[model samples]
Target: MNNDILDKITFDTGGLVPAIAQQHDTGEVLMMAWMNRDAVLETLEKGQVCYWSRSRGKLWRKGESSGHVQRLVNFRIDCDGDTLLLLVDQTGVACHTGRHNCFFQSVRDGEVEIISEVEISPDEMYGNKSGGK
Candidate 1:
């Protein structure tokens, strides 16, 4: 699979690099997550996005629970080699809050405003009330 490029990535001390998921066709950013070496390799091998869940301390297969899977289109590393960009075809809402993306908050005039509305209820996505990401 020519994964030699992985060697050039500089993961942090936690063995994780910030991965930003962006829509492949459009420029809309879906979400940001963390990826360890295994997560990165798994995503490449499986053609689906996988992330390291810092809160759960485990490999988080996106859409495993929400059915909002992200299919890998392209993977890229920043010039600094410390960050990664994943161009993906998103299946559904990316945010746990049921928003299309995570960056729903906007700050203007020193006031925080929500720029996006929830498309789906988190309860419906997670099948629970916690609405966790």
Candidate 2:
């Protein structure tokens, strides 16, 4: 199918939309990322998960810096055409904190708390600052 087929889909305010990655077999939601047109196009064309980095303001390939690539298996649009559900085969940790997923924490009692401990050191993925502050 051509990318044009998705021209009917509606994108939101930032010319970007929410994309959720779920495990193809187990149906576990792996992560959520923003996707602009180019990211969506590149994801489909490359079969690798590509996301728009909000903080750095650039296109970020999932495993480029962390070696935790998300392989695309399939994709679908929400009924309103504003959200995307991606079926993927994820490799390594999906969270920057090196957990299986970014949603390692759960909220309860109107407060947020950590449900999972760090699976790997942040320095392993993001490097560290030597200054003690």
Per-residue lDDT of 40-59 in model 1, one digit per residue for the tens?
Answer: 98999999999999998999
Candidate 2 residue-wise lDDT, 54-130, digit = tens: 87788888888777789999978888888899999998777777777778778899989887777767677655622
Q: Would you list the clashing residue pairs of candidate 2?
A: none
Q: How close is candidate 1 to the true structure, as a TM-score?
A: 0.95
Q: Clash pairs of candidate 1?
A: none
For model 2 the local lDDT of residue 15 reads 84
Error of 2 at 111 (Å): 3.9
Alpha carbon lDDT of residue 50, candidate 1?
95
- TM-score of every model versus the real structure: 0.95, 0.87
Global lDDT of each model? Answer: 0.93, 0.81
